[model samples]
Target: MSEKYATIYKTIGQNIRRYRKEKGFTQETLAEKASISMSYLTKIEAPNCDKSFSLEVLLDISSALDIDVRNLLENIYSQPTI
Candidate 1:
């Protein structure tokens, strides 16, 4: 993948981690709530990890976190290119 897309994924992952922490939800709990595996959640939250997640996954995460889908992508577009 290109650096720009990588940055976007990283930014979104960071936002997810931040919100998940703020909500006091562990990766396991969030994964169950989002109907995904803990391993997948770990991958998505890993900094510098080059995994690509789908929009459905993002929506599931947002729903599990009780936040808007846009919240998970907060500051993504503004992130500097890698």
Candidate 2:
């Protein structure tokens, strides 16, 4: 994948982890609630992983977290490159 897209995924993953922690949910709990496999969730949260989730998965995660999808994408566009 391109570097730009990789950064975007990493940012999204960070946001997911941050919000999940804030909501006091374990990865297992969030995965279950989102109807996704724990392994898949792990891949999504792994900063170096190239795997990217679908829009459906993102919506499911947002619903599971009780937050809007935009929350998951917070600061993704504005963040500077690492």
Candidate 3:
């Protein structure tokens, strides 16, 4: 994948992690709430992994986290390189 997309995914993943922690949820809890496998959530949140997911998944995650999709997509470019 290109560097730009990598950064975007990383940022989204980091944001997910941050919000998940803020909500006091475990990976398993969030995954179940999002209707995704815990392992997939693990991969998406892994900084060294470049995983891609669908918009529906993003929406599901956002809904589960009780946050806007923009929160996950925020600060993509502004974040320092992973």
Candidate 4:
């Protein structure tokens, strides 16, 4: 993952937070469902962005969210058409 990817993940993190909250899952609970440590989820959710992420971790979260991984990634990286 490169620095350019970090911004996309950061945006994805925001969407994850919004959706996760809407679904009524606490961070800790989501972490458990995603099979990630709470601390790792915290890092992912941090305002400070990073592109370094495990694909496995992403898959877990995507499964837990009941959303397709491609859709999630697309949502993360999509830019509005002018």
Q: Model 4: what TM-score? A: 0.77
Residue 66 CA displacement from its true place in model 3, Å = 0.6
Give Cα-based local distance difference scores for all models: 0.91, 0.89, 0.90, 0.75
Cα-based TM-score, every candidate? 0.92, 0.89, 0.89, 0.77
Best by lDDT: 1
Per-model clash counts, in order, read: 0, 0, 0, 0
lDDT of 4 by residue, 1-82 (tens): 5765677777777766766787799999889999988887887877774646777888898889887766456566374322
Q: Alpha carbon lDDT of residue 29, candidate 3?
A: 99
Cα RMSD (Å) per model? 1.2, 1.8, 2.0, 3.3
The best-first sequence of candidates by lDDT reads 1, 3, 2, 4
lDDT tens per residue, model 3, 1-82: 5665787888889899999999999999999999999999999999865788889999999999999999999898786664
- Which residue pairs collide, candidate 3? none
**CA deviation > 4 Å runs, candidate 3:** 1-4, 79-82
Per-residue lDDT of 2-81 in model 1, one digit per residue for the tens? 66589899889889999999999999999999999999899899997678899999999999999999889889778787
Better structure of 3 and 4 per TM-score: 3
Question: For model 3, how many clashes?
Answer: 0
Runs off by more than 4 Å, candidate 1 = none
Question: What tens-digit string does per-residue lDDT give for candidate 2 at 1-82?
Answer: 5565787888898899899999999999999999999999998898785778888999999999999999999988786654
Give candidate 2's root-mean-square deviation (CA, Å).
1.8
